[model samples]
Target chain A: MECYSELTCSLFVDGELTGDAARHLRDHLVTCQRCRDLVHALRAESRVLTESLRELPEEAPSPEAFSHLGFSWVWGDLAMMAAVLALGSTLFIWIDHLEIPGALEWFNPFSLNGLTNLMFNLSYYFAHGGTAMLTEYVAVVGGLFLVLLLGGSVLLLGRRWRLPKNGLGLLIVLLTFSLPGFALERRHEEFVTIAANQTVDDTLLAIGNTVRVEGVVNGDLLAFGRSVEVSGTVKGDLVSFAKRTVVSGSVEGRIYNFSQSLDLDGQLGHSIYGFTQSLRVADRGHVGDGIVAAAGDVSLEGEVKRSVDMLLSGNADLSGSIGRDMTVTGRGLTLTNTARVGGNLTARVRQLKGVHIADGAIIAGKRDVQVRVRKSQFARSRFYFRQALSFASAMLVGWLGLVLVPGFFRETTQAVGSGWRSLGLGIGILAGVPVAIVVVAITLVGIPIALMLFAAYLTAIYLAKIWVGAFLGWILLRPTGATRYDWLLGLLLGLLILTIVGFIPYLGGLVRFGIVCLGLGAFAWQLYHASRPAMTA
Target chain B: MIVEVEEGVVVEATSSEPSPLGAVIRMEERAQLRVAIAHLPENYRLPLVLRYYSELSYDEIAQQLGLRRNHVAVLILRAKQELRRKLAHRSK
Candidate 1:
């Protein structure tokens, strides 16, 4: 018989050979020295192979070794989210309660006329507020929140996602220095004083008890103090936030002032916009452009080369020469004998008798007086119609979300089981993101990012209620045979319920806020969980 | 000359003649052989390891690998051959 095949010898070494085969191989090996050597070598090879494999480490470390580390990391992410949320909500509530100067006091939500007035006032403020409106506290807090959010996200998510380590380091460094506190350290000057002979070529920022500029400033002047006095020449805009602002200089650009009282005794190349308690233009004051002010009392004794628009809470006394139209909405208006309006004079006051014009006061164009009237917003059919339209639009958005990302809703709804946790996360994201966006916008280079963030923030806010509505609908219906259509039906019912609750005077606002918190929290929770690495083998 | 195995002991074909090859492998040679086996391909390595390291029978290896009984035997033989070649090349 031929020598046993190496395959047969290997099987024999493993003791896998059957009775007849094993007996034959053993008999063959004894007679053939070559086969015997083959058998011996095979057995030795088998022993070595088994020992080597047994000594080798597993391909991946056992899951038990990493389970604890992974769990802690997940909890770390959750804690970070909660902390940021709490801090953000506190800041938001504080900012909301702040009594901003020049804010409309006649902002009656129950009147359509009041809404129109609010829109007009908001447009005016946005158009003229300029950089002075950006509060320092907001900028600082926003910067800090931005750094924490971005840095935390990268650090927490980077390892699991295997993001490039070098890039993460660079990003962390960039986020650290982007804080407004760091930037302010280099640019802020406390108790700034520019001497008579001094000239500042770069934009000047001064924040202290008092800011006095007596020389030339080639760039914009930003001053925030108890008292801001500028008796110099400003080649660019002058933005001042102070208790009292007095300008006796020539400003080549516009003037934006938010103060208790603003006195202009200088030449303005452009417009003068002031949100103040009292604003006065002295006899020597000359404005090349228009004058726009929201003030308690406005007295113009100088000359304005363009129109004058004033929203007053007390009264407007115009003794100066206005080259264009004059529009005043206030408690009362007065035009002295020296007052000269080259164009139309329009006054909207509490009463027509509140407008007093001297016989000698020259108005070259039409003079119109409108008596203000209060109307109930709920009385108007248009209000209900508008509300319906808004409701429909919201429903459309919710429907789209449901259709396109059903999985997302499922995940969010699942997270809603942890209610308080979701609420905390929700408050943080809602309040924190806007502040971060504002801070980013303050940095000119980050404007695009700010815009994108703003869009996302608005979308999140709009969707918050819808997400909650869907969850509510699902709970109430609890269809035995659930389907896509069943979810839609539940969504409709839930939205209807929410809408009715939202119409309930005082409780509506509170319920709406709760729903938003719940929805936003659940959404954020889902996102966090989704970002976790897949640990299952 | 005739050789026969009555039970476990080997009776040489020629009386008073000892075995030509050494049955016992040295510790260093066994270590070297183990390293060679580790370097074997997955198809060969897996069955070889399963058979020896795991102390599985041919039927068990075939069940794990989803292969025929005879095919497993062939793979193990190839695995041993590859390991021998590697060890020989390393010694050179």
Candidate 2:
């Protein structure tokens, strides 16, 4: 019979052999000294190995462990997100109909698509209330933002890229140009022209000289010459400062005027107020509320449905109807035959002429008239008080995150920013190879090398985005001192400055694409560096 | 206890003699020891000297392992031989 092998001994130990077969293996062990010794050694080694395994660390020991945020790490997070979303949705759906007032409102009965819209609208509704609602809105928005940011970060960080030296050099040049103060003045214009008829959005539409509108602007309008006319309807408010300002069309909202002469010929759906040097209103125009002004000459040929308080240097003309009250302090006053003062009229005028008041003109309040010839008794003496209520809502999810996962934010931020280059490089490599292969196949030998180089370049894009995302997240979260906040705010003032300003057809695309490439390159460098050691590990 | 064919009384009866029945009994004993050792975990490692002394006679192991006679003699005379014997006997 053959000698019992180590394999046979192992099988016997595992109780594979039965009855006499097992007995036979057992019999061999009584004589074979070498086999016995080998088994003994193997047994001792196994025990030690098992014990050592028990002592392995539960978590990554070093901070540098986070220096390489890989797919597995992010996949774990994604899984958590999916779980939480599921739980939240389920809880909301189950308990929403129970009428738990405060929380119940969040449970919209609408379809899933409608729920998003509802949530958006509900947030806007709460936006009007005090800081509490604003706070809640910010919190929700910040959370949504973070999830998206992290998702993108993961994708970007995992990429890699390579490019030709010249391409790299060009990227560097573009990055240098992207810095502030590289070129300050973007577009030069004292007066910009808007065509006679064109549709414009919220963008700064240029037309004529020295015409400024700070109202709830709707569509586009034409501006021409020294006279500034807003004849077209404005869905939003209108704010203008001009030599002579005219609003012939309807203003759905408030109108703030800073001009030498102000004229409102059309109806104002809301209030109209101004601070001007000279104010004039044609007979066809009207004022929705009281008019406050400091001017040289104040003339109103139209109707004032409410009150009017004016201070003028030369003269004041009133041919319009005053519904409530009229107060004027000017050098001279003139009331035409068409003037009908429904309410009291208080004035300080040097001379009064053509003072015509129809017998039927109702004057409910006491009427007093005073001629103030002195130049010092101007309208600047009166100040209209306004309530100053400031609103600041910062949606801090970090505090929440700190409550939930103490180290998640800091760790994630470090992982994203520090490793941005390597991560981007990884992604570029992952994406580039297949794309390059496809290109190579299509173009044959003509593009194989080029495709390879392009693949290298693309692999670095995610690195750039990861770094930018981390910086943006940090900047957005930093509760630095007031001055730091101010500085940061100032720094971010141009978040989309290039986008808005660079929309000049072909040049815009070039500039933006160039900027994008530079950003991608920088991130790619960071991600590439970050990802290397991780790959080795 | 004192049954012997040649010169010495067989102590501990670790293996059977040259008879057919003795060979079967010796094979069974050898297999038992192997089973015990094989049951241990994969990472475990026993001391080589202890294992060899407990499992094999000095002359047989010396021949197989290419060790000198004096070395095996010395290993058996030392406390290592006694420790292995006691451990094996206790385990069984």
Top-scoring candidate (lDDT):
1
Every candidate's TM-score, chain A alone: 0.59, 0.32
Off by over 4 Å in 1: A1-73, A78-189, A258-261, A272-280, A291-299, A308-317, A327-334, A340-342, A345-368, A396-419, A422-500, A512-537, B1-92
For model 1 the TM-score comes to 0.53
For model 2, the superposed segments whose C-alpha errors exceed 4 Å read A1-197, A201-207, A210-216, A219-225, A351-364, A373-537, B1-92
Q: Write the per-residue lDDT of candidate 1 for residues A1-537, one digit (tens) a residue.
A: 799878888778777887998999888877899999888776655554554545432311112223423455556557766766665565445433422112211211223443455466556669986443233323343445555565555445543344357756855765564443233311334467888899888766665567888998888787766788889888888877788999898888999887899998998899989899999999999999999999999999999999999999989999999999999999999999999999999999987678899999999999998888656767888878987898788778777776787767766765665678888767666656776664454332244556666897777777777778777888899987657787777778888899889879899998888888788778766665554322111
- Provide the global lDDT of candidate 1 against the true structure: 0.71
Among all windows of 10 consecutive residues in model 2 chain A, the one with the lowest summed lDDT is A384-393
Q: What is the TM-score of chain A in candidate 1?
A: 0.59
TM-score of chain B of 1: 0.67
Task: Give the Cα error of residue A117 in candidate 1, in Å.
Answer: 37
What are the chain B TM-scores of all models? 0.67, 0.32
Q: What DockQ does each candidate score versus the true complex, computed on alpha carbons?
A: 0.17, 0.01
